[model samples]
Target: MSKFRKKGKKSQPAVNTAALPDIVFMLLFFFMVTTVMRETSLKVVNKIPSATEVAKLEKKSLVSYIYIGKPIAALEDAFGSAPRIQLNDAFASKEDILLFVENEKLDRSEQERNKITWSLKVDKNTKMGIVTDVKQELRKADALKLNYSSKATDNIAN
Candidate 1:
């Protein structure tokens, strides 16, 4: 009925930004609470194997540490000196590692032995051949559940 329709009006869509910040905060809190920290007595850098499928060991008592380095360096590091590997120190060679693991497997209570796990930490500059040789030594000792990890977060290889 008017000479012309009222000038059309456009509505600006409403955007809800309030919930976004809350959601972001919730996610951050969840991750912070759920994160795990690995505990270890000694520190060394190692390059561990990666597998899409793997199993975790339940018992900590059966675990043992293996250190590999140039024969001289390994010996020196095991004993009194800088960069000491004294997480239950007293190992100098493959023989010593094997002996210690064997003793641990035997000394543990029957219940503890059933859930044993072994872990190794070695220097990055160490040779693969030496690493393989050490693995073989561990195998001979009947240390079946072996695990390896880097000493420092920064040293973890891609």
Candidate 2:
């Protein structure tokens, strides 16, 4: 036999997966850190109207949402079918907006406070009266930078 001949039938070595678990855990932690979960459970009937001119918000981090609509079926018995304003997770009166605005402002840095945009998510059939009230509250809060939340539509006239 030649000196350099292969030994019998040497079995191929198995893959060294020593770092596999570390890589898997690293990716898991990365996803856990980067993934954004829903923050609030909506309690209103939020059927936002559509508009042809709807523009996608560029910086969602600087936007705060104000939900306006009648209570959902689950809450109608308690809150009635009248239009209600939802700030975060709870129902709020028009007067509460000022405090809410202040709180939102406080959450951001001084430079970003003025840049924050308040987005009004109003239902299609919702009367203008409540919307007017919300606007008045925002005005009192000096939250003048407002945006109406609406989805993209091909035509509004239809």
The lDDT values for all models are 0.59, 0.92
Task: Report, for all candidates in order, the number of backbone clashes.
Answer: 0, 0
Q: lDDT score, residue 29, model 1?
A: 98
CA shift of 10, model 2, Å: 18
User: Residue by residue across 61-113, what tens digits does model 2's lDDT show?
Assistant: 89999999999999999999999999999999998999999999999999999
lDDT of 1 by residue, 61-103 (tens): 5666665533343454454332323235443555566767767
lDDT of 1 at 68: 51
Root-mean-square deviation of each candidate, in angstroms?
Answer: 9.0, 4.5
